[model samples]
Target: MATSKLHVAMYPWFAFGHFIPFLHLSNKLAQRGLKVSYLLPKGALPKLQQLNHHPHLVQFFPLVIPHVDGLPPGAETASDVPFPLHDLLISAMDKTKDQVETILGNLKPDIVFFDFGRWIPSLTRRLGSMSIYYSVVNACSMAFSMVPAKGLTLETTLDEQIQPPPGYPSTTVIIKRDEAPHIVLVNDPPRAASFCLRLTAILKESDAIALRTCNEIEGPFCDYIAQQYSKPVLLTGPVLPETSATQLEEKWDKWLNKFEAGSVAYCAFGSQITLQKEQFQEIILGFELSGSPFLVALTPPHGYSTIEEALPEGFKERVGDRGWVHGGWVPQTLILEHPSVGCFVSHCGFGSMWESLVSDCQIVLIPFLPDQVMGARLMVQELKVAIEVERGVDWIIGKESLSKSINLVMDKESELGNSVRNNHVKFKSIFSSKDWQDEKIGTFVQDLQFILESGK
Candidate 1:
């Protein structure tokens, strides 16, 4: 008899940062001739479909988002809701477990890859399917996550949490106490409780763990996770798709036409982070001080409607003709690949990290939240490939610090800048090697096939 075709399913957290990488992995698997069913909310399907991935091998199955009490009408994903209501969105997502289980029951894939499907571990086994907990964060964050949060509780001192977790003596912990989410510190107890519960479930129940990093990037942490969990840990090699710059819109094309190669600063803070008014002004001021022709994409905090409302007064006229500030949507991957772009000022989201690493651009990391801080740590502390814009108590960043960070990374002459830039070239070389990436991903695929065939 011909062997059955391997079928896989993927369910990612609704946030775009989480969702996009899952989609990339699905596409990669599909290319390798595995059938994939991508499960997500209906609202996100349109944008993902536009990526034009493997139509035959990968299929999207949309789940209706149930009504959430605090969630605004028509808002389905984390990006659609304001920050305060994010937990409510997760609660609503949890309600979709029944529907998800129903769909998975019918599809009956060999293995399901999931991020934030908290009920997955229990449901998968009952349905005769195995589940893989796919971490969208870096390996350091995963290593820290496997550290029991029960012991590291709300009362735990910031100093205590900042130290390296038990076994990793030499490695510095990437996340600072202040840089952690309010939920983590018990500033919001209910949300923290919910997050902890889900994390615990995933940790206790999953059949395997998968990460989006390679041994070269975070080998120690990767090894630690395997030893801690005693489960197979698959490293998915960052899943960076080979991309070329697409035709830019008139506005961006016209603006970028003026700069010399590698002279402009490209700043984007990903889809979820919204800069407060004060923070926004400081970043703009820093860009002005750096005197680099730049492009900034800002998503203002809730209640603000426009870039004009968020920026400092007269900020536009002062930097006139030298910078472009686009609110809401900007083509980030394309901009990163642009010849005129020299450096990336980012929130250090993992997807952004992968994109920046794959490009020639030097990185200036301003990480305000959980895994973002860990990503910054991995680049700056471990890899030495990026500069972090410093934040004070409670993770609030000031304008002077922002400006200084920009100037520091953009200055090729300075010692620190030269070191970081050289590291960037080194990482970019590794990420760009098709053979290296193929070897990693190929090993992961072979291991996955072994697990399914041997039922390990």
Candidate 2:
């Protein structure tokens, strides 16, 4: 009998950032002849359907977990809910366990790949399939900053940080030193030297672990992670469908007529971070003050009582037709590709950063919260590609700082603007000239094939 098609199931937390990457992986796996199934709530199906072109090899299951009390009813995606990250995680864990158990019983997948939501370990173990934890962030980041592990079982009070155990690269710890003691040592990297270590200690104890980053941008670090884990590292790249400048401009032009050249600034934050009302107002005013045409994707705060009412008076009128505020989904890749889009004001999510880099647009980073600050620092300091806005404690960026950063990047005649544009071109050529699809995705497919054949 033809070897049964490798049956794989993917479970991502119901956020667009997490879901999109997982979907891209599934599409790649499907192209490589593996059968893939995605488990998420029903409402996310349309979004996935829009992105997916390969229907024959992949399928979706609508999970029917009960809604949490505080979350909005019928909220399909995390963006739809106003719940805080911690509460959302808790509810997702409970719901995921119930939904996954039911799906596993019916589907009996050969392998289940999941985002590192808290409930996956127990659910995968009970199912007796190869359970692979697919992390969307850099392995180094996770290794250093993850909470200590208590046990595989999902419980309320596991205060342990996740860290690499002994035998990994001692110097490459991703978390801060002060946070080290609280971490639960794992077989993954920054601690282990090779996949053999990870396999024997972590994978064998659990199932498998995979990283979502590719070799082009993160080759050495990815090699380190794979060696430490002793398991195949799947180097899926940025995981976006390829598009050209011509096509991108066409799409943007269709949306708004005035976008011809150097007209619009594209702005968006990744799904998770929220801005305080004061900071949000500062951004609104900053964009108003910059006098540049702009398009902003804003997700109103879920908890803060005053969020929706915080827009500056006459804000919409002043920027009429010159600015567009999309409270829902905006086609980001399309906007960035537009020739008229000169600069990006972004929250600096890695996915957004990669998208911006590939699009060859000048970027002004205004990080609102979490690891975004680190990403912004990387772009400004290490990559020398983007300009970062100065912010006070807790990332409350002021209007003046925001206006200055936007003006500096958007001013095409200015030295700072020219430098950013040059860097943007350089980064674009690096990523776009090479067939990242072939170099990165090709290797990932080969390794995944090897893993499947090896039967371990």
Candidate 3:
């Protein structure tokens, strides 16, 4: 008789950032001979179902929740509804608890891996399955935000402020001017880190804690997290599918054939986050002034009439055939892999950064809001793999600065461009190789298997 495969379920937040990592994790587990099921709201089923052809790997289980007051009717995913982040987190917690309970009652899994969403612990407890907390972001960011090296309590008066601890090299401090309205204030004593720290503490009692990062990039930070928590830390390198260079080449050849070598700049923000009309127009003008062939993925403005209406007067005619504007969705991985695509002007989202790195493309960082600024800082300051645009608090770059920056990056002999390309080559050598596969993702599976088999 064959040994029973461990059943694992993953619950990710509805946003693409959360969903993409969860999909990678599930695919990894399915490849390891475990029975993996990914749970999302019914409306999100289509995207997962599209990827369901993966051989013998994973299953998609979409759960439909009845429309509740305050939530939009027929809202299938978190992205479908336009609630504030705090409100979305709260509603997802409430809805997931009931939905996860129903699913687990029908087919109990040995373990459940969940993104660090609110109410995950309570739901996992109710389901009677061992739970693992997966942090999809960088461990440094997670640790710094959640748990400071020195124990310090945040004052309620400055609830939105994040001051750097004494002796940190960076001069900037993060501040949140606005609150998300839905979350309540708890006056409890400072415990582990933030919610994620609390979740890690709980996982210590349950099974294990896993993070989606690699030792190659986040070694020191990953070590700190492990030593502090006294738990087995698993570092799964940027969880992306392994595709051949030939495959990428084939898909991107047609797109790249139109442009000169090392000429076109690829631009995209992550899936979530939209820009207003004013900011959008500034970007268009910046690209126009650069005098380079460009491919920009246009997202709908947060509150605009249409994309065409948002553009500046006669902007479309000037660029004409030199520019490509793709709405809805484009084959991003394929586009990035193209040889003619030399530079990336990005929102500095982590997934996009990983894709840019793997594609060995030079990057021009243009971060809008949230953790993106930090990601941009890391790439430009820490890794020296990208150039940051000198923009204001509103992320508006003047046409002159934008044009200068673009020329600086696109110039083949320019020091900045050459440095970016060199670092791109180094990052590609480290991350895109097959040798690190075992140490990166294989160890994660081994640890997961141990937990499932031990049945502790």
Write down the TM-score of every candidate.
Answer: 0.90, 0.77, 0.83
- Clashing residue pairs in all predictions, respectively, total 0, 19, 0
Candidate 2, poorest ten consecutive residues by summed lDDT: 150-159
Reference-based lDDT, each prediction: 0.79, 0.65, 0.67
For candidate 1, write residues 332-381 as lDDT tens digits.
88777778998899888888889889888878998766678778888999
Instruction: Report the alpha-carbon TM-score of model 3 versus the true structure.
Output: 0.83
The order by descending lDDT is 1, 3, 2
Q: Which candidate number would show the highest lDDT if scored against the true structure?
A: 1
Rank all candidate structures by their TM-score, best first, as comma-separated numbers. 1, 3, 2
Model 3 poorest ten-residue lDDT run: 180-189
Off by over 4 Å in 1: 1-4, 153-190, 392-394
Which candidate, 1 or 3, would have the higher lDDT against the true structure? 1
Candidate 2 residues 1-456, lDDT tens each?
Answer: 112267888887677878888887787677667788888877778867866656888888887756677666676676786544335544654665766788787888877887544455566667767777776665444433332331221121122234444432232223324423322223233222222222234343435567766555556656655565566666666666546334444535765557667667778886666665666777878787788788877766544444336567788777787776666667787777667888788888878877878876778997643346556656787668899887654435777887788888877688978887887787777676546654666676565557756765
